[model samples]
Target chain A: MSRVRLSFTPAPVHVRTARLVGVAVARRAGVAEELLDEVRLAIGEACARAVALHRQYGLTELVLVEMSDGPTYTVRVIDRAPIEAGLGLAALPPDELADEALTDEALTVGVGFALLAGFVEDLQVRPVDEGVGTEVRMAWPVGR
Target chain B: MDLSLTTRAIGEHTVLEVGGEVDVYTAPRLRERLVELIDGGARRIIVDLGRVDFLDSTGLGVLVGALKRLRPVNGSFGLICDKEPLLKIFRITALDQVFPIYATLEAAISADSSGSGSGE
Candidate 1:
């Protein structure tokens, strides 16, 4: 049985909330502060990337952050973005950015993802829809 | 994250006493304040970060940006980061090569005047 899902906008203000809840989860799971920082940075960077991508598309209904109790912890940002996971960004340079995942001309821009991928431990991209919709799934190890 | 910055002028040197966390959120306020100070003819600056509890990459970016802005004018900038964590960041990022790191703001000002720390 997973925990309650907490959904909120991925704005800068909401990033703080996600961090706060993340701290609580880290405390309960006995994650170290250093690891907690990595989690916060990765999640914040992910949410920031999501928000910037969907800026011209008005906004998503809301970003869903689902937390559960298992061997590992996960944070997911659900947005109806027209992102394709088949761009093969797994080997792209982390110093720069590979916006090939974004088909939209305007959306395929920025160094936000470069920073995000470089910092996050387990970075994954999945196409959760028919040729669109991206769910950036990241996992951080527990037990410090 | 409240930032309280105080300026003290000791002869030809300008010292900035920065307090609170310098991150992506609070760095904008500092950037604006620095721009104002530089515009008002305060050239040589020593950013006293002894009171600052936290600083991030964005904050580092602002500091680097300030240094870039001041360098062409022959104005110099230094940081007072005696704390371990802050000092570690400077060393890790190799920013210590770009900007002088001093034990105290007073030392930086003194060294600047004596020409010992003139971009050494």
Candidate 2:
């Protein structure tokens, strides 16, 4: 299995770089061309969510991204924010949550996850076993 | 790519031309510009994304925030996005139904100020 690991400070600017790197790795892993956009969007959303949480909590730790290609291409974004932030996102209904998110600042972070879920068919949001944060795991099938 | 935003008056509509990528890092600038336009009494606003190469949920949130901001004043807000990749993002997020999207800037500018247009 081939693996790529990226770590960056939880800043908005670095999120773009993470997306670019994630897409490059996905392409090299044989992810389909049409699915590249989805991969890019998913990575952006995941990293953005991590950045938002880190900023909200005033934490300066680096966000972790791991990409692995085996039977399927998998990308994982790990954020060191409170577990509630990530767990709460999966429970919210994207459509109804999105309508109210415009007016509500607290609901804004969840909107990103909603978009991530929409873009990635295979998605998992859960807490890290050894940390106090959440992990956003997404996978797409490879053509080769 | 860096995000570029410029606004110009087209008839009664103020068109905000957006180019480059709109992500978490740059969305705040777009949001601030939208707020400035609304604060400056731009009632009919159309964001032209034909030149935009990338857009994320943060960008979508900025647009949605602009729409909500204009609603209290009965302002009209629309978008011009023709690219399939960008359109797919809107479709996936279900934002296509929320925003009046036009395939061209002309369609958006000429559409009924009432905010109805042929969207792709």
Q: Against the true structure, whose DockQ is highest?
A: 2
Tens digits of per-residue lDDT, candidate 1, B3-116, equal 789998878888888997664457678888888888899888889998986565556656766666686788877888898766755554455666788997778888888876
The RMSD of every model to the true structure, in order and in angstroms, is 6.2, 2.6
Clash pairs, model 2 backbone: none
- Tell how far residue B92 is off in model 1, in angstroms: 5.2
| Among all candidates shown, the one with the greatest lDDT | 2
TM-score of each: 0.68, 0.92
Ten-residue segment with the worst summed lDDT in candidate 2 chain B? B111-120
Which regions in candidate 1 have their CA more than 4 angstroms from the true location?
A1-6, A48-69, A77-120, A123-138, B88-96, B114-120
Model 1 lDDT vs. the true structure? 0.63
lDDT of 1 by residue, A57-138 (tens): 6665576666555666777665566665322333223222212232322112222344446556677777765536677777
Considering just the first chain, candidate 2 attains a TM-score of 0.89
* Every model's DockQ: 0.10, 0.51
**Model 1 residue-pair collision total:** 0
